[model samples]
Target: MPDTAASSTHLTLLDDLLKRALAHGADAADAVMIRSDSVGASWRMGKAEDLERSESTDVGLRVIRGKKQAVVATTDLNPAGFDELAERAIAMAKVSPDDDYCGLADPALYATDLQDLDLDDHPDQGAERLIARAREAEEAALAVKGVKQSEGGSASVGRTTMALAIRGEGARFEASYSASSHSVSCSVIAEDGNGAMERDYDFSSARHFEDLDSPADVGRRAAENTVRRVGARKMGSGKMPIVYDPRVSGGLVGHLSQAVNGASVARGTSFLKEKMGQKIFADGIRIVDDPLRQRGLRSRAVDGEGVAVRRLNLIDDGVLQSWILDTSTARQLGLETTGHAGRGTGGPPSPGPTNLYMEAGRLSVDDLIADIQEGFYVVELIGMGVNYVTGDYSRGAAGFWIENGRIAHPVSEMTVAGNLKDMFRQITPASDLTFRYGVNAPTLRIDGMTVAGA
Candidate 1:
């Protein structure tokens, strides 16, 4: 850890331990330090129901001797504690069994220049403010006409600091961010004596509270979504085009991408083995992983291994471009790291996407559905039924009916089944691109999917 005067001084302590490890018969070493603070408040039935606040700091060190490596981590930040931890890590490394694949990243691959990212920095607003926000969101939900009882509402805030250092190639960075989120949900009893409806809305803001969604707006949307679900019925089972809203589309794409990772390929478990440069999807489909998006939820200047991060094309114009790779997996497969390493003190690094997103399409959501005689606009899915090695896919789905380009009624308790390989090639995307989460996608349409229902 480079020297810093802030709370992240534990980073320096970690750096010092790494140096000690190198001097104590280790070939390579690295260190990481992290500090975080969080607060939360909840309101229900017009009263405060729960509140919590906490802060914590931790440091970890790793040592590698030839083919053997060991790691030790501790939340205690005192100098004496750090020294003991370092000694223990070296001792563990000495006794560890040697494997051919364990080592620190090459010095040539380390990032030198650090990027100045703008993360959250706001004065701590006490529990009272959090409670107030929770109450406001809940009250707005309860005020809706058909809302009989609010299930609950909550507000939360979190701040974090992180630092990293490597032995021979010293690199250091410090970043802090603040995030707040509020959510409200309610159950509505219909006036016609038909049944009950339920829904919820959530709003999140980073940097400050002013960026959050209005309580009234959240409440109204929740009420609308809930009301639409009333009297949902099952549809006849058949193969048809399926449209996935942005929220659900992201999850669908994520599942597909995970199966294409290089680690899985190296292990002979990826369905995409030997499919590089092959046409794997519709002509318009593209999947990209970007780590430098400004203020992006998962954006980072460097990967977990201190490698420079950049945008990578996983799939371009339906062609399988590349698979996500970490250092170990890349080495095993004779490829370069894709700057997708995800690891911490306790485990080896794994490949993961940074701000993964699918490129938007030309047609608006309505236009994409206009020609469909019948379809389903999926809003949510439950339970997982995906086989990475075989590319088989199935899941429980619930959403609204699409008829002649219009949303008709909600449908529930159905199953969607198809081969992921076929589904990718048959899919189409809508023009609506909303950036609300780490994984994002436009509304997507997959044709000829099997929907199991009555």
Candidate 2:
């Protein structure tokens, strides 16, 4: 656990800033305070390459006068700077444009429990240790049979402490949280004897150092994947099932996130704007946003607006059930906030997801693809040719080909095109869901996509 006393100190600063804003002729206000420490190192070709470390503090003040709000941020936290910053913010609010739906969140929704979420960890390492990690990872990758050139291996770690405080009509409170992370990665090229080459990479991140994958293992995985990609050929143009590997499948769910964002629905620009309570995916499909998950990469004890966030069943049994909503977006659509408010120093609250993932289905990956006579198993997505408003999807893709329910040669330089609305309805998941990123899905299969070829 992070030092409770340190968090309290930071929270006090935020509390004082909010009070200062209210004292300076603002009707209500909130403040964000952050402190961070980071370190990184890199190595290549059996030698140390570089090292870096940094520490910083940032504080931002947002003051509301009646229906207007203004925000200001600074790295200077001097007592003298605090008063001037708050006074300036209040002054700016007087000339700001008015908004009917802008203000503090409903006081009743404020978070009270702050300590139960385990969002912090301790990683004790310096330049020497980081460099050693990078060196070992690169060495492991270069040891692989067909692995040739090293793109370098790297390691990084960081710690951050954040606090938010709010003051309104009769409500006043503050919440603080801390986060720590450690990660190692490697990228390398694999060369075939006939002068063909391919590159791939793997990485792992965790709140605690001990939870990270071994450096050697990360490097080995990267090299193995790259070596497997050597001599990749092209497939023919046709309509076929496109299976998404776990590494890249999360992006499919990300598209769903954007479609269901309340802001898009409010503006009538999302393809899924009118899809509420409708069956949008195959039966048994479910997606969730969980903010209280222990050590989650995007977990938060309280939301960006000081509201108590909760787990949301965004998609329930293949039906579109909810929109990711913040206080303002929800009001625009005549609904309650879904506890998805996210904000930074100089902007209004916006809807966002936290620890989002789709539930696994009942079939193993092998079983899921056993019936495919010919298909493409995607490994990497190259560009963003997505149209959220029209639901059109086109992107450069590379992966292996599946023939007669078995893996064939690797394929590259292909384009997959389809409509997301149609793609969602046809997507079938395999029971291999592993929580590896902020957005995660298992091996997924989509039928009837037009795969453009060489």
Candidate 3:
């Protein structure tokens, strides 16, 4: 984790920058500082391939004059340079095109009573541990029978600190937070006697080092996944049921997110633009976005814009409940901000989800697949063939074929096609939801999809 002394210094620096921007004839301003340190190691075939360590600090300032705003970024932390940075921002804002919705958030809505989400952890041991982790993972993967070659193993640990300060009419705010992350991953190829080779990989990440999966466990899982695809064959073309494993099921939820993004909806480019208060999914389905989840991968007490954050039901009872929004997009749609704003050093704030997930269903994985006699169980997806405007979905897929309600053989080089509108309506959720990614869903089964293969 980052030291408190450094965090305090960053907050002070942001405050000084915001004050300078205001003094230079800007109506309102906000400044953010980000500092990061990371260590990584990669090992392949029992030898260390690379070792890396990095540290940096970056700052961005947004200044608004009247209805126009300008943003500037810099890596130089010298206080003497702040005057020129502020002056440049104000001058740019003066000549910038007018935008009615380009200012700070409402002062009344500023976040207060921030909570500790426990996102940071103790410091890492060093590069030595990371190298050992990578070596161990590669060795474990090579130990598995049928495994032909190692694709290398990797481990990384990182910490980031963010500080923000806002100076607007009747409102002044400052906040700082730090978070840590650790990850281990392994990839390997398996070959059958016929000279056919398949590759698979697995990895686990968490906010704390102690929560990550063991290197051996990751290696074994990756090897097992690779071994299963040793004898993959292409199936025939036909329309059938499709069951998505947990690894790929989250993509469906991501599509939903894009369809409901406030920016896309405002631009009239989303298929779900007119889906408010409509049944977009099967009955009894619920989807949630919670930013306050303890130790969540993307958890935060407040959004990137210093707005209060909370849990929201983006979907409830299979109905479209809310749109992912920020202050600017919300204003364009004549709605209040949903506190979903996110930002980086080079651009303005935008709306996005944090800790988004779908609720699990009552049916088990086996029960979900029991009813499908001839279907495709998708484990991997390829291509970006989704049309958000029309909801037309088509993607290259690979996985196993289902015969007699059981996994039969691996299939590859297949394309699955269906309209998302129909797919969402025909979807069924299984009781295997896990919180492994920022966006999560259970094992999903969608009926009435077409599969094309040899």
Best-performing candidate as measured by lDDT = 3
Question: How far off is residue 403 in model 2, in Å?
Answer: 0.7
Candidate 3 lDDT, 278-301, residue by residue in tens = 999999999999999988999988
What is the number of backbone collisions in each predicted candidate, taken in the order shown? 1, 0, 0
In order, candidate lDDTs are: 0.74, 0.89, 0.92
Better of 1 and 3 by TM-score: 3
The order of the candidates by lDDT, greatest first, is: 3, 2, 1
Please, what's the RMSD in Å of model 2?
1.2
- Work out the TM-score per prediction: 0.92, 0.98, 0.98
Number of the candidate with higher TM-score, 2 or 3: 3
Which is the winner by lDDT between candidate 1 and candidate 3? 3
lDDT score, candidate 3, position 430: 98
Model 1 Cα shift for residue 418 (angstroms): 0.8
